[model samples]
Structures are given as structure tokens and as C-alpha cells.
Target: MNGSGKDDKQRNRVIAKNEAERQTTGDIRVSAWTIVFAIIVGAIAVYIVWAWLHR
Candidate 1:
């Protein structure tokens, strides 16, 4: 019984660790995309303003 309980605890810890890692990876991916999108938007805005002023 004790051995079985210990195994369950270990399994639960492993599952929790895996879940945390997955979440962190997802967060990093989302952050990277957000930064890329922000850059594209900023570039577009700058181009529009420059074109308007020059014209």
C-alpha cells in the first residue's frame, strides 16, 4: 500500500511538471508572436505617416 501511494505521488508530480512546462512554452510562443505583430503594425503606421507628409 505504501509503495503504491509513493508511486502515485511521483506520477502526480511528473504530470504537474509537464503541465507547467507546456504552459511556459505556450506563453513564450504567444509572446513572440505578439512582438512580431506589434513590429509589423508599427512599420505600417510609420509608412502611412511618411507617405502622407511627403505627398
Candidate 2:
């Protein structure tokens, strides 16, 4: 038999890997601002409760 089938399979694998890598290169899967906003909201909640308990 010939080796074209094996070469085709290898090329397909390389193309798929490159595509997956490209998709994630510029993608912000997690936003830093979202995390910061959540932290700020949590701190505000804690401070409000602390002030209420002491006042």
C-alpha cells in the first residue's frame, strides 16, 4: 500500500491543533474586570454588615 493515507491523517491533526490554538490566543475566557467587580461588591457587603453590627 501507499503512504498517502498516513500523511493525510498527520496533516489533518496538525491543522486541527493550529485552529484550536488560534481560537484561544486572543480569547478572554475570564475577564479581569468581572473578577474585580465581584471583589468590590463583596467588600461593600462585608463593610455594610460590620457597620450595622457595631452601630
TM of each candidate vs. truth? 0.93, 0.48
lDDT measured at residue 45 in model 1 versus the true structure, 0 to 100: 100
Which candidate gets the maximum lDDT versus the true structure? 1
Tell me the tens digit of each residue's lDDT in model 2 across 1-55. 4699999999999999999987776364456667888999999999999999999
Q: Alpha-carbon error at 5 in model 2, in Å?
A: 22
- Residue lDDT tens for model 1, 1-55: 6999999999999999999999999999999999999999999999999999999
Candidate 2 backbone collisions, by pair: none
Task: Give Cα-based local distance difference scores for all models.
Answer: 0.99, 0.86
For candidate 1, what is the lDDT? 0.99
Q: By TM-score, how accurate is candidate 2? A: 0.48
C-alpha root-mean-square deviation, each candidate: 1.1, 3.9
Off by over 4 Å in 2: 1-30
Error of 2 at 52 (Å): 0.5
Q: Model 1 clash pairs?
A: none
